[model samples]
Target chain A: SQTIHQWPATLVQPVGSPLSLECTVEGTSNPNLYWYRQAAGRGLQLLFYSVGIGQISSEVPQNLSASRPQDRQFILSSKKLLLSDSGFYLCAARGGPTGTYNEQFFGPGTRLTVL
Target chain B: AQSVTQLDSHVSVSEGTPVLLRCNYSSSYSPSLFWYVQHPNKGLQLLLKYTSAATLVKGINGFEAEFKKSETSFHLTKPSAHMSDAAEYFCVVSDLWGKLQFGAGTQVVVTP
Candidate 1:
């Protein structure tokens, strides 16, 4: 069975501080990775997605960026965080292009509170 | 472009009663649809999916949904509600490549 791990489960960061959230998947290879953010009581907003290592696509322009350093290792980072960046950040993965598999498995999200 | 609309922002139901949550969607092509559940502060868990093969899909936790093409609706239903079912549910539509578009979630409240 495949599983995803993310950390720190919760974080409190000061405004304008650097931020880093890491995600990794086990028991799968060459999986597509995605980053999403959900504001309080709001729907998920796609941040970034990667097809392979060193390949990333940004869905929304923001202070946050995502990088796939390895096939199953994805990282979300920001040089300087903004107050608007405070939200529940989620990492998701799906089996690579094998056909019409559209289901995405999500990781335990990181709750970032920028104060 | 694909989109999902959860008609009710919140739904309240009594325990052991039937539960229904409404969802509507718009897609340019034959799309894939899904319903996901999220416990408070937890990650989303996929409940069910429709990929044009079956109009009625059964999911985990005794939840089921019917895909109506003419009405453009996929409404989730449960025969008996449980207290544990109190959570937020999201209706999502996606393409074959996993580019998902989610609806503003509907919060389900189970009353004792």
Candidate 2:
């Protein structure tokens, strides 16, 4: 089993403020990490995914960026936050046997509110 | 393209009644379908999955989903609903690269 840890369960930021959300994992190594955003009344949107350290794939071009500094550390950052960026941000990792159709385990999630 | 559609945005059920969440997917090839549950203000938890192997998949907390290839549907059901079963459910389809396509969540309301 994998445990995902997300800090600052909730955040409130002003428009144009910089943003950063951290996600760390334990009980697994080199797991594929992903960042998703769930806007109110909308589905989850895939923002980014990392296969390994320093490798990131952006699913949608937006104001936010993701980085994998360590094997189990994934971070989501934004240079300037917008009101539209307010949403529930989730961090997930693919778990199970590699090269198989595995399910993702999610962290507690961070609720970001941009005013 | 691969995508998933959860038929209902919300469903209300009695505690002792059956539960059903309908989902349909679109893919050119055989897709890996999954059901995930999310509690209020919480993260996601995998309910069950249906790959090419089986049409019926059983998941945690006594939830199950049956995959119908003919209709391209993967619907989740529980024999009897519980208060704890009130949560949002998502229908997902996985691509070859392991990326998942999630459908709009269906919020279940279990009433006593």
| C-alpha-based local distance difference test score of model 1 | 0.94
| Deviating ranges (above 4 Å) for candidate 1 | none
Model 2 stretches astray by more than 4 angstroms: A96-98
lDDT of 2 by residue, A32-78 (tens): 99999999888899999999999999999999999999999999999
Native contacts kept (model 1): 0.64
TM value for model 1: 0.98
Scoring the B chain of model 2 against the true B chain gives a TM-score of 0.98
Please provide, for model 1 over A17-108, each residue's C-alpha lDDT reduced to its tens digit, 9 standing for 90 to 100. Answer: 99999999997899989999999989999999998999999999999888998899999999999999999999999885846756899998
Error of 1 at A83 (Å): 0.6
- For residue A8, what is the lDDT in candidate 1? 97
Candidate 2 CAPRI grade: medium
| Residue-by-residue lDDT tens digits, candidate 1, B15-57 | 9999999999999987789999999999999999999988999
Clashes of each: 0, 0
lDDT of 1 at A43: 93
